[model samples]
Target: MEKRRLGRTDIDVTSVCLGTMTWGEQNTEDEAHTQLDYAMDRGINFIDAAEMYPVPGRAETQGRTETYIGNWIEARKNRDQYILATKVVGRSEMTWTRDSENLTRQTPAQIDEAVEKSLKRLKTDYIDLYQLHWPDRPINGFGFHSYEDYATDDMVAFEDILGALNRHVEKGNIRHIGLSNESSWATMKFLQVAETNGWPRMVSNQCVYSLVARRFDYERAEIAMREKVGLLAYSPLAMGMLTGKYDSGPTPKGSRKDLFPTFLGRYDLAKAAIGDCNETAKKLDLTPTQFALKFVESRQFVTSNIIGATTMDQLAENIDAHEIDWTEEMEKEAHRIHQSYRSPVA
Candidate 1:
């Protein structure tokens, strides 16, 4: 596995990071530990989780993902071997994550509480990268049904959020800060604020980026190159659609599509475009998984390609894709697919 510099920091993370969102819900603790051990043996040293994980987030499974990782960390006692990353939720109604409030926000108190709980759940003294799951700004959310802008005065400011994170840095609770599902303006503003305050910089942006989701490439790619805050690409497989498993058959049993069909949101809109990418992969004698995963990994602006799996076989296949040599022919085909589809999901 290739390692890349994490932003402008001295630390280096594998180009392929293990994603843990499905651990507690789709998988059990033993399975999560198995995946962790296998991933480390495969030379991957970056792991990412979130507070409200196992996605269809509910109170029952809210913190189970972190607890599973925490258990693995406790048993293995290998905290120094890998970089652990997790996120604090942005503005939302996932109030179960809070102690007293009915809403989650990026306010200093909430950030402090979030970090403290995540530390306890992860069983780690320090988090390598602590990210805001998304911004607190009132804007279009995932697979938006409408766009509405609220008053600017209604949200937590960037400096305050970074300031809260800085306190964690000072307390040796987290090493770096990052953004997710963030926009260009906020990305730059955070950097500017950090520079002004001489605070820890926003080192990366974890966002939805894949063959069918190239919105990051349009503008943020340049910011990544010049500012050194590269992307932590998520959903690189288009939620497994690019794997071609769903290309021709009924939804596989025990699969995400079969269990929680709504979680595959927005991908349904780009069915034809996804088909083009997957079909093109077949024509080139490549597994659609390889083509899709490599496409995200190959991008210059990517710090790490976060891959998730519910089973060992899927884990192996995703890890194997990292070894496939990306060819010029493949790049051209990815380009052709993008031009035809124009990032329909974004």
Candidate 2:
């Protein structure tokens, strides 16, 4: 794999980041270790994880993904070999992430709490890139729309959030900071705040950017290109929907759809566009998975492509997708599909 600069930071991450959300839930520790080993062998130096992961995030299994990575680091004793990135959960109804306070905002205390616990769980002294998983503001996310009255609570201020991250940077617990599921306006605001306050600048924006989900290209791609906050695109395969296995109907057994039926609600809502994209890929003589993955990876705004899988077969195929050279015809087909769907989920 190739290396790319993470925003304006000195760090260089692999173009293909190994995603670990399914590690503790759908896979075992050995399997997680195996995946890490394979990814490393393939020269993938970027590994993304989260504090509340192994999604379908339960109170019991919330931190298991980090724990599995921690175990891998301990067993391998090669923490410095890769660039590690992890995230702090934004405000959500899942209050089990915190204790007794009912606090979900990015307060200084909460940021400290999240970082320390994540470091402990990850069994590492420092994270290469620590990310705010999403905005604390009230917004329709994860494909839900229909705007409600925008009420601004006394949540953590952007400056305070950066301040907290700077402290972690000083302590060497986190080397850099990043954002996810954020908007272009928010990205510019964060940049402005950082520039004015002389605080740590955000290194990247991790968001959903697949062949079917092209909303980022509308606005945020410019932020990435100009501000150096390149994209760490998640769900590049639309939760395996673009893999062409689900087009034949009733969800495959043991697949992501079967395992977490609600996981790909956004893709399901835009199934027509996804079908068109798959068809276009077939017409172009490319498997839908290869076409979708390569298209996302080929984006100039993309710093890295985060890929997840429950099985090694899926993992291997996804990793192999990086080898396929994206063609202009693939881009044209992707654009045609988007013209029809035009962000049905968003």
Q: Highest lDDT among the candidates is held by which one?
A: 1
| lDDT score, candidate 1, position 38 | 100
Sequence-dependent TM-score of model 1: 0.98
Q: What is the C-alpha RMSD of each candidate to the true structure, in Å?
A: 1.1, 1.4
**Candidate 2 on 1-346: residue-level lDDT in tens?**
8789999987888889999999888899999999999999989999999888988889989999999999999889999899999999888876777775574777788889999999999999999999999888877667845556566654567888888999999999999999999888778988999899888899899998888778888889988999999999998988888899999978788887898887777666787888888888888888888999999889999999999987888889999988988777777877777787787655
lDDT per model vs. reference? 0.93, 0.87
Tens digit of per-residue lDDT, candidate 1, span 1-346: 9999999999999999999999888999999999999999999999999999979899888999999999999999999999999999999999999989978999999999999999999998999999999889877757644457789998999889999999999999999999999888899999999999999999999999999999898889999999999999999998899999998879999988999998797898999999999889989998999999999999999999999999999999999998999999999999988888888886
Q: Which stretch of 10 consecutive residues in model 1 shows the poorest summed lDDT? A: 140-149
Clashes per candidate, residues 3 or more apart or on different chains: 0, 0
Taking all chains together, each candidate's TM-score versus the true structure is 0.98, 0.97
Q: Model 2 lDDT vs. the true structure?
A: 0.87
